[model samples]
Target: MSGMEGPVLVVPGLNGSGPNHWQSWMEALIGARRVDQDDWTRPDIDLWSARVADAIVAQARPVWLVAHSFGCLASVVAVSRLADRIAGALLVAPASPDKFGITARIPDTPLPFPTVLAASRNDPWMKFMSAARWADRWGARLIDLGEAGHVNTESGHGAWPEGLELFRQLQASAPAMTGPLQD
Candidate 1:
């Protein structure tokens, strides 16, 4: 849990994580790389999914996903495509695809890798029950973060160290993959 074997892919939500966002702090603290989306404000589900998949493909080593908001949805979509490359995932404050006026694209099947879905009780983007439903469907563990307001800087969490702790727990519990790292 203390040390992960591969690159930590930091995926942000709308407008991308600002310099002071927790995801950015994670990058600074653990040397994670951001999944670059072509357009941050206007999120296209397919495009975001593709970007996540591409990031995994580019990595020779195993990749651990640290995704927030809409990025969590994209990472979920990309998981099946990059299952072998993913070590585990931390999905924080997932923004329901339905909120964007699009029909849900979430898959019904359980994810290939172990995952944790962190939900905020008072997040405007999604209801806690909806997140719990998603966790059930994806077979992910749901962690309730009470009244955390989307777990963003606007919610008073510029550096969410607790999220890092959750990632560590996931890593510790996940089964080890057998293949050699790409480098």
Candidate 2:
């Protein structure tokens, strides 16, 4: 979507995004960097967030996060300490913190930078209302995708153009980076 002002960090959920997954396609489409976790099968917020934070630190510019499912959770936590290094975030189909017994670990306060959260009405990972609650808590704009299960390749969302549009919108709304990069 034109020239991006910052690097796009694509963060995938459990087991990682496969070749057929939309995250993989978006990375190919935009040259986005993927945040690879050491153990994708395990959902550990601390470890996952550390990996995401490290990725952001490695970027030469502020980053825009495109995260899915459990990766959404990790990205949010990672940005908590590095908010100034972030341009914006597009979080999709976030897994429920309650499901992982990490609700207390996730911040209940508003996020520092612009963030958009897209959720499905019938996602098996999280209830719609629960997603709404978290969206409000994070002060993120929420987009409702009715009955779109998980919004993954298995749910028939490979090469999701609509999600790309949402990311573009978030990018447009993000504040422009200024001055020198923080150390």
RMSD of 1: 2.1
TM-score of 1: 0.93
Q: List the residue pairs that clash in candidate 2.
A: none
lDDT of 2 by residue, 1-183 (tens): 322488999999988999999999999999999999998899899999999999999988889999999999999899999998888899999999889999888987888888899999999999999999999999999999999999999999889999999999898877787435867
Q: After superposition, how far is residue 130 of candidate 2 from its true place, in Å?
A: 0.5
lDDT of 1 by residue, 11-127 (tens): 999999999899999889999999999899989889999999999888877789999999998888888767878889999999987987654577767887889999999999999
Give candidate 2's root-mean-square deviation (CA, Å).
1.8
Candidate 1: residue 156 lDDT (0-100) = 84
State each model's CA lDDT, in order.
0.88, 0.92
Candidate 2 residue runs with Cα over 4 Å from true position? 1-4, 178-180
Off by over 4 Å in 1: 1-3, 181-183
C-alpha lDDT of candidate 2 relative to the true structure: 0.92
